[model samples]
Target: MKITLDRVNENFHFKLKNERGHIVDVDSRAEFGGSDLGASPMELVLMGVAGCSAIDMISILKKQRQEITSFRAEVEGERVQVGEAKPFKDIHIVFYLEGPINEDKAVRAAQLSFEKYCSVSKTLEPTATIHYKVVLNNKSL
Candidate 1:
């Protein structure tokens, strides 16, 4: 997969385009002289993790014949300084699922996503610790 980045302005704002012609805007934090036009690169990394795992979990659950009404995932990351770069130290993902879904199936879907299926999480696994929790119908599973 190839991606191209073009500067949007004289500053840190840029637009990234993939081979499929999808676009994602990227910018630095305001403190770094950016205008906050879009999400920062670090934030996009977290987004990738959330998105990848969401797809995996949803696909797994669907294949298992679970009835899903709504699903949402919240991802939070803690960063640590490494030389001049602040990289994520750990990431916590909370999945909230609603519907007449089996609790164990929901939990297993999440487990499979993080432990085996999600490529984005696996890419960050060496540097960042990944943790996930599943909440099914307002109850932690």
Candidate 2:
């Protein structure tokens, strides 16, 4: 997979393009770009991880005969600044599952997705510390 980034202005704003010709704009706080409109490279990486896990978890739950009422994946990253590079040293994922399914089964499904299913998590494992937790119905149970 190859992507190209083009500078949109003299500022930090840029346009990203993939090999498939899809384009997305990225910018910094100096511009009017907000989180929803633009994201930093690190934010994009976190988003990729979250999106991958969400897809995997939902698919796994569906296969497990669970009906999902609501699902949310929140990801937080801790970055280590070394000179000019800022890499994510730790990443935490909170998987929120709200439904009538068994809590244990839901947790297991999410764990499986992070450990074995999500490609993003697997790819980033060697570089970043990835941790995940499943919260069911506002309780640990």
Highest TM-score model number:
1
Residue 77 in model 1: lDDT: 99
Cα lDDT tens digits, model 1, 24-126, are 9999878989989999999999999999999999999999999899999999999999999999999999999999999989999999999998999999999
Model 2, range 19-88, lDDT digits (tens) per residue?
Answer: 9999887877644344334787788899999999899888888988999899998899998988999888
Q: Where in model 2 is the C-alpha error above 4 Å?
A: 19-21, 31-37
Model 2 error, position 25 (Å): 1.9
- Which one wins on lDDT? 1
* Model 2 Cα RMSD, 1 decimal: 2.9
What's the lDDT of the predicted structure labeled candidate 1? Answer: 0.95
Model 2: pairs clashing at backbone N, Cα or C within 3 Å: none
